[model samples]
Target chain A: MKILGAIIIIAASTWAGFEWAKKLSERPKQLRQLKVALQSLEAEIVYGLTPLGQACIHLAEQLPKPLAWFFETVNKKLEEGSSSAQEAWDSSLNEIWKFTAFRQGEMEVMRQLGATIGKHDRDHQQKQLRLALIHLEREEGEAKEEQVKYEKMIKSLGFLAGILLVILLI
Target chain B: MKEILDVLPDTIRRVIEQMDTDIKKGIEEIRIRILRPLEIIVDGKSIIPDSDGGKHVITPQESGQLLNKLSQYSLYALEEELKRGYITIQGGHRVGLAGKVITEKGQVKAIKHIASFNIRVAKQKVGIADRFVPYLYDGKWLNTILIGPPQTGKTTLLRDLARIISTGDIARKLPSFKVGIVDERSEIAGCVNGVPQHHLGDRIDVLDACPKAEGMMMMIRSMSPDVLVVDEIGRKEDSEAILEAVNAGIQIIMTMHGNTMEDLFRRPSIRPLLDMGVFDRMIELTRANGPGTINRIRNQHGKEVYCKKVI
Candidate 1:
């Protein structure tokens, strides 16, 4: 047999070995941080909007790119001077809220997830939290699913590469 | 009649006229260049190759491509036979085509769409299979696949093997063995009916234009000869039939398109056959810087078991 043929076999084996190892290495703790962040976002939406989601919005504002450009566009359209928070909310979220979605869509839908706590809708918030828990499971599978996709991609590449190696060696 | 058709430079009108009067519908002519030891003509143009090697630069035109299109002649696959150096197309009718080798990753898949080729009319020579009588009998008829890429003389080899195995011997005045040939493309015995137009010696019976898969099944039940010789087994279906023949203790001689034995092993389509260990011998051919000719034949171990001079 040609040397190239031998190389192809070796390359295929190595790739298979790597994929086998990757599947064995992932831990549940490494995924916890992202899960926590997703839950916090869920809480804000379910309740009367938490300080965390508001903080995220502020960060999105300071992002200095899409948020900054969008804020600038709306600020210029405003009738008079207003504080940055109101300015940011009115210009950024207000413009977005007018769309069919933000006003009467997901927010209106999420309103039933929580119980009314001192004028806040508790049933809307609770339902939102329940859905968030379900969504967390969905997010967990994303990583594992991605790993599977990666494994397949490796196998396909390895197959072709192995064949080429065989040809080159021969 | 073929000679009369050969004389006129067949134009579109002549083509229509020929069609009206039982004329063949493919290409009317093909310009080919010969490296040596042969002669050719197409549409009044002398077909010869550039001296840079056996590269016959044919002009790509409608009329130029016409003569090699397809034919109604007996199952000789005239053009394919010619390309493999089986017979020479002296004048009038010429065959033409060349196939692109489909390679996957790097392994050869199969040859497809013969772009350039030749058609050589088959002429029978009466007795030629007598030489291999000793090698075939006493349970000597080994199931074989006469493998070689396009134009490596698979059909010619097949015709000879069929002739030898069918008839016991032609030279020593030995008893002719009753042989059945499945000429799937009519390229083998050039059978017009049950009769063979080409020389397959006296011992061979031919099945023409029948698919190898169907022919094998048909021949097994009907002919039941000591040996089964066929040409160009390509797909998995064809292999299955050959396998069935092999499993039934019926000896088979077939061919495939592969230049070397190593190449034969790498082919996914043919790989199963190799793994199954059916083919006793694999004949490989390569055009040796000249016209078409066999390079050598290798045993199952890929050793040069047999070599022949182009006589």
Candidate 2:
């Protein structure tokens, strides 16, 4: 029974470590997806001249989950007709941020983007989108660096900590 | 009309909605200005709705919200419209904007801080041109020019004429003609996303919001329309393009802002077209007996063909 408890405890810690490592890895990938989404948004606004609400719905359909859910929620809020574009965008971002691996810096970048997304002309909108892309690129680089530096360490630390706990308990 | 109401702020929309159906039906324009009472034009008269003993004065926030809704929260898509100082919403309703002008090196770049909006309601009166069809169409549709002042329903007449020509009136013994409309201001067809909201029939094609001169030539080359319909042509390039279309054996129906035949001759840009007799019929319209009242119809030689009898 004691051996079984040790095995279960180690397994739990290792699983928790893997989950953390996965999140660390996901940050960079999610940031890249966000950049692609913003690029598509720029194309839609500049070339297609699609309205922002419509563009969000389009992105929702084209993108993968979490991001898709984010855009879909934004579109729903916009279609509700009560909230402004910025309000819809910010609210959706807040709701989806908990589900994402995005940090506060990335959140701040997106919030800034929300403020001007549909307010300006094409040239100004394009500039604002590009600015957000630059900030996201910086965050993505940091995420990648953290993932490389800590992912393996965290995985090993989980096993090591579990062994230490087992020793102390025994 | 619903589209127009959707863009208005909540309070004004509610008041307008509560108005009598007669006033609602006759509504032509809804004018909103910052710090001013909301005014609606019905048959060329402005009527401010009574709002519980206090007039519903338009606030700056309301105007901002109006602009936001009109743009569909995407002002980036309205780059050209901001420069043009007007926006054509869905259902062909036009909102004229007045604001601080942003200029770049002597050129008007765009309108910013928009504080005034004039929402012109486009009501398509189908069959308003039926009586005139017998006069305007002979063996082939004539190169006709509808002359009128602003708010005299020239576009309404032209829209009906396009529908009639494109659909073909069996009762009137008129066969459907291949009609192409170069709707420069998006007025005649009230097109939304290049598709006309008006009932212009299946045999018609519209070049929405294209400049008159270039669009005329484009229509002739691509659409091969039997009759080309254009609105508000007074520009120099418009006359040149009309001459080109005429030489290409295409019948052109167009409108100009003028009260009388003298108004046509007064403009140097239109003088050459008049001298060449480019227009087969010049129909003058006036609001004297309510909008769309045909004052007189003159042949190419300036002889009266049909005149409204003063009763």
Candidate 3:
């Protein structure tokens, strides 16, 4: 029963480590997905001339989870007709920020974009979108670098720490 | 009407909603300006709706909200509309915007900081042209021009005429003709994204927001419409296009801003068309009998065919 408990402790620690590593890897991948989503949004705004609410709904349908949830929340807020576009965008960003692997820099970029999303003309809005893309691209690069540097070490560290605990107990 | 109310701010909308049904039905235009009492026009007279106790003075925030709602929270999509100083909403209601003009190289680019909104209610008076159908049709639809000043219901009559021509009057035994409308201001058809919001019949096609001259030519070359309808033509290019359409064997029904035949002759831009006798019938509209009242209908030879009796 003691051996079983030791094994279980190691397994739990290793599983937790893998989850952490997975999140590290997910940051860059999600950032890339976010870039693609923003590109499509730019297309919707510039080419399709679709309203922000409709654009959000389109992104929600086309995107994967968490991001999709974010857009869906914005769309819901817009459809309520109470909140402005900026308010809708900011609130949705706050709600989804916890679920995302994005850092503060990315959050700032998104918050800045929400301010001008539906307020300006096509040319100005397009410029704002491109600016957001640039900021997000920088954030994505940093996330990728962090992922490569620490993902493996963190995974192994969790297992090594669990083994050390087992040894101490023994 | 509901669409117009949808774009209005909460407070104004609530007041408008609380209005008597009779007053609501007669509402022609709802004018909202910053720091002014909200005014609505009924039968060419502006009346401020009596709020519970105080006047409903419009705030800047309310104006901004109205503009936002009108644009569907996306001002980016309204680049052309802002430049045009008006937006045609769903249900063919036009919201005229007044604000600081943004100019680029001496050209008006767009209206920024919109401060005033004139929500013109487009009521489709279906079959209003029934009485004039016999006068307008002589075995074939005549090349007609509806002459009227602003707020005289020329567009309203023109829209009904298009419907009549496209749908064909079963009782009058007029066969349905292929009709194309070059809606320059999007007023005649009240189109939203190329689809006409008004109930113009199945055989009608509209080029929404296209300039009058080019759209007429495009409609002729592409659609080959039996009857081509255009609104508010006074430019030189419009007359040229009207001549071309007439030459192409297409029946043209167009509107002009003028009170009398002298008004048509006074304008150098339209004088050429008048000299060429392009228009077969000239129908004058006035506010004498409240809008859409036919003041006179003159033939190509400038003889009055019908005149309203001074009662």
Candidate number that wins on lDDT, 1 or 3: 3
Residue lDDT tens for model 1, B109-211: 4334444444443333333333434433444676666666776556766777676665544464445556667777667776543467655666666676677
Docking quality tier of candidate 1?
incorrect
Ranking by lDDT: 2, 3, 1
- Candidate 2, residues B131-242: lDDT per residue as tens digits? 8987898989999999999978898999999999999988777899999999888888988888899888999999988999999999989999999999999999999999
Global lDDT of each model? 0.51, 0.92, 0.91
Error of 1 at B174 (Å): 6.7
Q: Candidate 1 A-chain TM?
A: 0.34
DockQ of 3: 0.83
Stretches > 4 Å off in candidate 2? none
**Which 10-residue window of candidate 3 chain B scores lowest in summed lDDT?**
B42-51
DockQ of 1: 0.00
TM-score of chain A of 3: 0.95
Q: What is the interface RMSD of each candidate, in Å?
A: 39.7, 0.9, 1.0
